[model samples]
Target: MAKPLKCDVCSEPATVHLTQIINNQIHKIDLCESCAEQKGITDPSGYSLADLLVKPESQSAPEVAALSCPECGCTQREFKKTGRLGCGACYETFASVVNPALLNMHKGDSHKGKVPQRALERATFIDRLGTLEDGLKEAISSERYEDAARMRDEIIELKKAMEAAALED
Candidate 1:
């Protein structure tokens, strides 16, 4: 028998799929892919890093606030104040400073968005579009008509799925 179904959006095990969030003491309801896209929302949340880009003269460290690496002679104050590291070792040596700054700017270490799916079909279709389009580009570059035909079919299938997802909105 096939494995039990799971909510494709959130990677949770469930026969039924759902997408929701709690904001302002109220829960945002589940929306299919098209619905969510039409609303420009995602299941996962995201934050802007505009604040991280701030450079106030007052917040700047003192003249002797430099942190020099013993081995590479890199300074911690330079990295923190300017938000630029000279070498890859800076990531390991000064993680404390780098991590919090990133968290403050991005709200998380990674910036990947957790988009909610108000409609699942639309998400699937958009995914398919990427694969099909890439495959078609590759086949055309290699002058392969047969491969192009296969990509065309995949695109058609994706478009159909996208249409179905849109109807859910």
Candidate 2:
């Protein structure tokens, strides 16, 4: 009784559905037969997710070399010649020029590195330590010496535990 899904790219009646879960978020993509085939959905070996994700730019504009990053003053021509950017902001400024090369070189645009379990645990401990320190300051300002003492003791214990973990690693 439900209506069929439409293609995400072409708005046609979708025949193919792909769901991707990244960073605990669900991303759904619906593609019609023609669009799916054109995008190489049928052949896993030849599949290029970048082709579907990055829209083609207009070829009419030939003045891309004139483009420059507002933050670092790096020009497209300079990037093309040096193969590097002046600063972090140049990435966004020259994305149109850089994305195609990135797809060809890395086969993907994003980094998919795995975080170490210990690193995750350490990060959580650091965050909790910061929160406890903030709470201790608040308790002291509010004239609650007992609560402050308890938080201070907890903070010392957490620091010792974190140090022990680091030593174990």
TM-score of each: 0.32, 0.44
Candidate 2 lDDT (Cα, 0 to 1): 0.74
Displacement of the residue 130 alpha carbon in candidate 2, Å: 3.3
What are the Cα lDDT values of the candidates? 0.53, 0.74
Best-fitting candidate, measured by lDDT?
Answer: 2
Clashes of 2: 0
In terms of TM-score, how similar is model 2 to the real structure?
A: 0.44
lDDT for each residue of candidate 2 in 1-169, tens digit (9 for 90 to 100): 9988777677799998876554575545678999898777888685443345444434315566467899989876566455457998887877876665455335476668988899999999999999999999999999999999999999999999999998998
Instruction: Give me the candidate number with maximum TM-score.
Output: 2
Candidate 1 on 1-169: residue-level lDDT in tens? 9875432233345432333232433211333455334333443563112112222335545432445665576775455454456776766565655655455334476547666766454566677799889989999999999999989987887787677767777
What lDDT score goes with residue 26 in model 2? 52
lDDT of 1: 0.53
